[model samples]
Target chain A: MTGDGKFNIASEKHGESTVLRPEGDVDMSRSSTLRSALREALGDKPSRLVVDLAKVEYMDSSGLATLVEAARNARTQKVPLVLCGLTTKVRAVFEIARLHQFFEIADTASAAIEG
Target chain B: MADTKPHVYLELRSDPVYLSGARQLIASVAQRLGFDEMACSQIALAVDEALCNIIRHGYDRATDRPIWLSVWPGRKDGQDPGMLVVIEDEARQIDPTIIRGRELDDVRPGGLGVHIIKEVMDEVEYEAREPAGMRLTLYKRLVQKDDSQDADQAGASPAGSADQGRVSNDG
Candidate 1:
């Protein structure tokens, strides 16, 4: 969140799920903020936690690590952590790392929440 | 290999705070050299991961230590053309042969740095500095775009081409 001026985060409750929309590059400098946001989203114990990365232009391993860490915690808490709206660049990163199968990816935030 | 020494060199302290500046520098250089957005992002991510490892493993998160980064444009020598990045740190020499990214199937956080660097960069090499420290070299081949895009890009006004530039600063 501190790295790029375009970075922004907004959270909202959608039915049985909580959605956290992050806009901007998710790198080492901003990954901690993402982690904290994830923690905050999970604190309420929603049935599903959705992260909308529609505006995320870039994501590094740190961002991926943060997601994985949060996903592990979510699993323990019985909350499904869903990620959606991955840009081509972000998707390529997941593919190269061979981590696309580890996550529950959706095409949209609404779909993530619905599923 | 066309005398492709670094045209830009940056010296940074081994601190986490400098990571943002380092990423920005890589992104700028990649963009200036005509890398697409995706390519630029990948290059930035690779360099960022490299720096993170140097700060964490090499210097033990010691913010006062020195880490050097150099960037150079690779020439078209019947190979993929792109940029080369070198990162040098004064941390204990690491065995490049033993460095491995844990299997992706392991499914965990915190160990993805090495994997990300190796995955994104076309070529990765490591060398132990004499006596102490290490140097890591990463190469990313630029993807050639359609000629129309290049022509459109060429229409822009030009700043005098700098053959090489060195920037020494405390980060």
Candidate 2:
């Protein structure tokens, strides 16, 4: 994908769905970049917003917190938010915080867009 | 015989830019200690959260504050070799007893750092450092290949077990 120093985020649109892909480690240092991308995606008011984390290898609590805040914002905007392709490491973070229960997840962005 | 000696020591500023490098270093060490991929990632995440706390709360987001981290090969009882991570910071100190993860039902950002650290690590202790600042010690036991199946099963279930580990904030 694209590189912004240590982290990268690439965004695209498929029909009414907007997909944001963040690569590399999403930690305290790079979470704000992801946050900004998510906010911009939501601001577009797409029918659905999908975060494809297939490229993200590591995520800490700050990254989780950023997504949690985004999920809340998406809810307020009535935009469906979906997370797909969580690596084992990132999934464990979600599982540890029990955050897996809060967001809609799919195996892939296509599945999220379809369902 | 278990080695309880500190194997690595790191001194860093309270800057988020160094978080990724630190995580990689800790994960590599855990992997070398025989922790599986998942276990290593969890350990690294715990350390990252600890440092984030030190940077955010302890240093009040100041980028130049000093933070010290050390890793020690450890053993729990006479079984299982593991790692003990100690993080020290010189910043505002507070009552460790009052440090608690917020209710998950609140469904909010922030507060999950403490919860994740406690859940991932086998033991977590918070104590006020002398003069100024706090010291957080995290211990996680390495699960053997045979025990990994059981751990995986337990992990698949809901995560509200009081006996999952010990988290003491007795500063």
Candidate 3:
């Protein structure tokens, strides 16, 4: 699904983990796409989920809620979900909303994947 | 079709419904113009926040006066593609100085409008119009076709081009 004009999810079977790269504005409008991507990344079983937000220009409460929900779901299943490469503006939304404790945020995708 | 003037205006009664409808009008105008996705989203959010503030604070929602809204596609420079969003309300005059942005940490319901407007637009100004009312003028310069098209070509970018967006919740 296309929303907010920019989002990409490419699945790679790296033996265990899957990565989802999200770009563009993530607001109420783009939450569905984000949820779908997260679901697809997790699949039926459990695995490491890495969501990269290096190119995200904007995000709102709805977007933050989506991430919080995804993180909770991953926790229930004992799967590792890491968010990487967040832009300052997007980070500010999460920070201002006091939602930083929701997910494992890594400084870089490589670090998230390696860890 | 009638040869009507391009400008559109609406009077917002000191009612919740009127404020909401005014917000929708801004969204509709931005949508109809084929505005870049980010610009439309920004305006919609800003308009919603603005209208809520007007109804909740400016008009007191219990007053008899009406709020007024004017929407038109305008540019400061003839060569530039831009938009002018004007919201006028026949409520008590507001102190422009009081319009100072509130801290995000306040987390209160009343002040988010200022921050939303600041974030959404490149320029925003509030004024106390004569005859006892308030006027808010918002300006946004559209990232037109050529520049946005180029951004789309380069890589994953902000609402520069590919104007058609995927998912947007009305809220």
Root-mean-square deviation of every model: 8.0, 5.3, 10.7
Clashes of 2: 0
Q: Which tens-of-lDDT digit does each residue in B77-131 have in candidate 1?
A: 4345578898998899978998877898888887888887876677889899876
The sequence of per-residue lDDT tens digits that candidate 2 reaches over residues A1-115 is 4466958899899999999999888888888888888998998899999999999998888888899999999999999899999987688778888889999999998998887
Please, what are the lDDT tens digits per residue for candidate 2 over residues B39-139? Answer: 67778888999999889988889999999999876653335467888989998888999987888888888888888888878889999998788999998
Which candidate has the highest DockQ of all? Answer: 2
> After best superposition, candidate 1 residue B117: deviation in angstroms?
1.4
| Rank list by DockQ | 2, 1, 3
Rate residue B7 of model 1 by lDDT. Answer: 85
Report the Cα lDDT for residue A37, model 1: 89
Error of 3 at B37 (Å): 3.0
Higher-TM-score candidate of 2 and 3: 2
As a whole number from 0 to 100, the lDDT of residue B108 in candidate 3 is 30
lDDT of each: 0.79, 0.82, 0.64
Chain A TM-score from candidate 2 = 0.95
Fnat of candidates, each listed: 0.71, 0.78, 0.00
Candidates sorted on lDDT, descending: 2, 1, 3
Residue B119 in candidate 2 has what lDDT? 82
Over B93-169, each residue of candidate 3 has an lDDT whose tens digit, in order, gives 86787786566554332344466576666668899888778888886666654565564666733421222222223
The share of true interface contacts that also appear in candidate 1 amounts to 0.71
Give each model's clash number: 1, 0, 8
Q: Least lDDT summed over 10 consecutive residues: which range in candidate 1 chain B?
A: B159-168
